[model samples]
Target: MKIFRMKNCLLGSAFLLLLLLQFSCKSTYELGRKRAHGISDNRLYNQIVDSSLSYKSLWVKRFSAHYESNGKSQNVKGSIKILKDSIIMVQINAPTGILEVARIYITPDSVKIIDRLKKEYLTSDFFFLSEKLNMNVDFYTLQSILTNSIFQLRDLYERQRPFIRNFKGKAIGDKYVFLSDKAAKVERKLRKDKYSRLYRFNYQRFEIDPSLMKITDVIVREFGEEREMVLKYRDFVKLEEQKFPSELVFKVKDSIQSLSCKLKYNKLEIDEDLKFPFKVSNKFKRIYPD
Candidate 1:
């Protein structure tokens, strides 16, 4: 009879252990969701936007990166000097240790890119360096990098408002997911638009960490046909009263190409001696007469 009672006690102990494990897993998942949801709401978005716009000057190191299918990689290390409403100069170092200079002249009427490497330049009414890198970058991205401010999530949603018939957002585990009512419709419209080529690529998932207010992961789908890319941020620190990503990693489709960048900021002075060579050259007459 004592042996029988011992066996029963063991069985009960095992059952209790199983139950505890299940509860632990559920609690962990719930905590991740809660943390993610806390940051995705509208209030955090406004703080990010406000922080981005207050900076008038910036000086930082930027690493521009790219990948190819053959497992080859390219990195451009550079420093950027920004003078509000006037000029921006980017001095980049090629992988071959050659210096390539790009001067951007920003004005109300036009924007110009002067490439010193090839001695050629491009002009447009509204152009940003993100285009050169073939990345999905926009004004908000620029604002965030320049000012060390978090991106305003609301602004991103607002821009997509016209096409977003229905918006559903939720926190799943450690990730925050956003779904549009007419995702299919929006995809179709994007295909017909001039920017269709850019959106042709597919991503496995889109996620953001609400606590940091930063994009955490983007998994690429259909990688080779349309190269997939992911950007991860780390080592965030406050510089000049702003928080910025000190390390950035980019992973291409199939993991064929990978690039890691480390950023450093120094000698930050606002409204100092700055020059926008591109804008100045715009006023010069074409040396080679057409």
Candidate 2:
């Protein structure tokens, strides 16, 4: 009788422990969802847009880059700019004693890029340029780049909840072996199932500050690539009622590049009358260069 009672007690304890774990997991999942929903709310996106447009004028640190494709090497030099959306003009002096003048015009429908030195014009819709540059060419990147507030957590992830069904990590020397949901179907779709792509996807593994919600480190692994890219942020400062990063570093395999920008603010005004014309320039013939 005592043996049977002991067995029942052991089974009861095991059952209780399982129930507690299940409840804990459910609670964590709900909390994560709530946090994600809060971040995705339109209020956050609007706030970001509002803060971006508040600055009337700022100085942009322009870099003229020369890349040697075969050698995988790049050389960059600095220039200064006074930007007003109405007349987007920039003067860049390269190390080779070449002064290039460029002008940009942004509208709701199109963007125009003109090179005064080459007398070349490139015009396209925002989406085209964004894809060509492999960047988010929206107000977000522009605002962060201009203000040197590029490293905020809010800026990086936009407060979206990660859809991680199962994640495992193993300590490997100084680094960690990260494995998440490996199912291709689950990985290919966007967070909210808004967009789908063929690119191999994996959950980024890194530590972030809970309070600031800022990403401290990020790792991206493509399905076929043997290595991953890692980005680290440092040296933060407050600029124009916002916090931003002064330095950004990107590393992939054997190549590493660091960009350090100094934010300069000046008393300039924006021409709210700026409009985007739905037209393409002839010089961009090479873009669709026949």
Candidate 3:
């Protein structure tokens, strides 16, 4: 009788263990299935794209800037004007008066910077800027940055812009993370159907705010290097039924040095015909670099 009781007890224990295992597997499977389905639905992406700003022009009355590089910090005030999709003008001035310290003018094909203190001016293109900054960039990316909109990290406008749906987005916590690379399985499927290529989908990650449907952060991964460039946006304010981030931060770090810039927007006006004045003084030497 004792032996029979022992065998029965062991059998009951094993049965309970098997049941627990099955339940765990089923729960995990269900969760994964739901997640996959949600990503497939992709309503979040659509919402995000739709939330991007549509304006003919923008004029920023005042903005504060704080920059930190290698344990040093500085603060200044500035203003920006944008002729939407065409030109951007930025002016950095002294903290007290209207004495301009530096001015930058950017367009679809050109970039010009005037350094008041150094008494020089620089005329360059996006290619040189990319070489110095060590990232793939173009005019569209810069425009997106200033306007707090979503954009891809490559300079493939003439060839083909990236299709955001090529990659997948996953909801984590309160935000959605969209990466710019397709999975092996998805790649195979697309290629099998002769789908258009993803236009050089590099390793990039964009974090979007679910409530505001704006991109809060963008991370770019450099090939053959373990470094990342991060651009973060926050402190959004709504105007005319649209949201814009009033505060934005950019950071880049490597083994040797680190850099950070924080910008605060004080005022914004949209659809205003703005002036972009850029005059190169004769005293300032010209530097057109390749």
Candidate 4:
């Protein structure tokens, strides 16, 4: 009888151990899935595109910068003063902090970059930069990149206001479809096809956080083999009930040269009165690089 009781105790202990092991494994798997995918449902997925593009504010932003090109590298400091839709002023400083090395002022119509070290300035339209790098870039594109907003016009534009271009949006994994005016027409005609007509969209895939619907990464390759750019945002922070990126890393690759940039935000101020101090002295010569 004692032996029988002993055997039953052993069997119960083994069963309990097996149950614990199964529970532990299940918990670990759940945690990992939550971490990777965040809270998501069909509705959340559908709404993410609109939520990501809705962030709007004006203020000054600053970060420590690390940049590299080919093999050369440099540590620098930078700040941006944004007046939404009107202007964006950028200042880049060398590590020494004694003198500002570069100042860029971008308006809807033009871009002006002043090199303090070289005592020269380059003033040109968006086409100049686009042609020089063989990339499709304009004021809004750069603004969206800096602000962690959607790059595609369909998501970026507000529903109440008239859209600059006709865009049709749909969700795809971590990205959203941004069909252009021409592409939207193509999509309507090709809807009957079994294969996805997603190829007709104007914008490429842009990755975003599932929960917050904030832009987390973007890779621009539409311009083809001549140029490509990759941007990744990490270390997010919540400010003013909005998600702000604490770290941004970007790489721009072109036939002539490649540039890599990493930005670590030390300070961020939103909806504050900001000042933009930008002017090129008469002593500075104007230099144009095409």
Off by over 4 Å in 3: 1-42, 155-161, 182-202, 288-290
lDDT tens per residue, model 2, 62-178: 433332222344343333332333323233343463653444454334545554444455556665433322333453333343332222222133244432224333333323233
Error of 1 at 144 (Å): 4.5
Among these predictions, the greatest TM-score belongs to 3
- lDDT of candidates 1 onward, in order: 0.40, 0.34, 0.59, 0.52
Worst 10 residues of 1 by lDDT: 18-27
Candidate 3 per-residue lDDT, tens place, 148-261, comes to: 676775542224545564456788766677766544443464469743343333356787766666777887754334455787766566665676666666776666666666
Which prediction has more favorable TM-score, 2 or 4?
4
- In model 2, which runs have C-alpha deviations exceeding 4 angstroms? 1-58, 61-72, 78-91, 96-98, 101-109, 135-213, 220-230, 240-242, 250-290
Selected candidate, larger TM-score, 1 vs 4: 4
lDDT of 1 by residue, 33-61 (tens): 33554444354444334544344655543
TM-scores for all candidates? 0.51, 0.41, 0.73, 0.65
| Candidate 2, lDDT over the whole model | 0.34
> For model 4, how does the per-residue alpha-carbon lDDT over 14-131 read when each residue is reduced to its tens digit?
1111100000011111111112333333444355545543333454344555666667666665566777676777666566654666776768787677767667777878665445
